[model samples]
Target: MGSDFYQQSILPFAGIIIKICRAYTHSQEDFEDYYQEVCLQIWRSRDNFNAESKWSTWIYKVALNVCLTHLKQRKKGEQQFVSDALPDEVHDDAKAFGSDELNLLYNAIKHLSEIDRAVILLYLEEKSYAEIGEIIGANTNSIGVRITRIKERLNKFIQAQE
Candidate 1:
């Protein structure tokens, strides 16, 4: 992809990566490392971008892989991050949605199996079922059914908070 396309199409998803970081990291520092790693992974994979899947779908996979790699290395006693940094676009809306109600949502998302969480997040983001299936490497016919169950489970978790 051209630099202009990356600046436009890929850059807009920075917030999504930040949101994913917020869900996965416990501190500002770790989040920064995870976010940067995700971007780097996406950059490395750009040459291989296949039009078969939506850009967002491909990004979600790369972001998750970056987090999982960092988390694994962290478990091995690596110093995964050295700083807490915030990009200019990260703002109050992300922090606002991260409130108690959405913290519950984030926590609920965490409870899902890795691939399940990927599927559900894309679903919530309103990606087509076909796109989600392509992203998760699952059957399109089954994604809708899995998403329905995911919503039901999330509803249960949210209600139990009451």
Candidate 2:
């Protein structure tokens, strides 16, 4: 049952998990840990899904919540020491979405408040304001306003990098 549910449900939405984890983590090790936690969480919460929203929406919420919690825990000093050097193997996420501009954008995103990071990541994925609101627990109206502001802040950060 677990294998079947995983193949059918979790595997299909893995990209969403990957993207969210990438946005919330700085290093490859942290990304892998967050990805595993998110998958475990989605599996554990499978029975709790009431289907009020799409499965993808539920997955996003789980992934974001896990990452946010992980971030907070790290701030409290659960974080491990990592070197400043890049990993030998290019990150799969980086290879898949690699570009200087995207790197700059991601660096800018890291500066956002947690909620703003989630909002902009979903916006980049082209999720509708309604869907984003459903995932992030914001109203659709606020999602629109937040996205506008996030974009403005992102533009300034990116320009400053030039």
Candidate 3:
């Protein structure tokens, strides 16, 4: 991507992409791969974004979709090797959440079904149920219900860890 495009289009929303990528990836390497792929896809598909929604929303949708697609294409029944190092973009945000807590949360999130994972990630990012519903193709009511269930599941997972 050109410096101008990155500056004008991708730079402002890089955090959104990194956050979504972190949720969907297991290791720093995987996160980097997904992040690069998302950037490329965004540049390639910029024409499809018609300003119907916020740029952040479009980026979120694209990043989640790309990560989900990458996960599906990987071979099944294999372990995801995690590393301690966080990408620079994610490090500051992860610190805000507390690394251990964020690790536990993201690890729990990884177990959710793809769509449920997307919903919960958006919810964590403080997106409204209506906005998350629009991105994930669910209604607001369903987004709320799914988020409740996802939280219950996550609580159980965290408790089990403790």
Candidate 1 lDDT tens digits, 16-60: 787676667767678777876787678878878887767777788
lDDT against the true structure, per candidate, is 0.75, 0.84, 0.81
Stretches > 4 Å off in candidate 3: 76-98
Give the TM-score (vs. native) of candidate 3.
Answer: 0.86
Clashes found in each candidate (C-alpha, N, C closer than 3 A): 0, 0, 0
User: Each model's RMSD to truth, in Å?
Assistant: 2.9, 4.2, 3.9
- Model 1: lDDT equals 0.75
Q: Which stretches of candidate 1 lie over 4 Å from their true place?
A: 1-6, 75-84
Candidate 1, residue 84: how far the Cα is off, in Å: 4.6
Please give, for residues 5-59, the per-residue lDDT of candidate 2 as tens digits: 7778877777788888888989877877787778788988888999998888899
Best by lDDT: 2
Which of 1 and 3 is the better model by lDDT? 3
Q: What does candidate 3's lDDT look like per residue over 73-161, in tens digits?
A: 76465434433354365456545544787788889988888888898889988999889988998878887778899999999999999
Cα error of candidate 2 at position 61, Å: 0.5
Ranking by TM-score: 2, 3, 1
Lowest lDDT 10-residue stretch of candidate 2: 81-90
Ordering by lDDT: 2, 3, 1
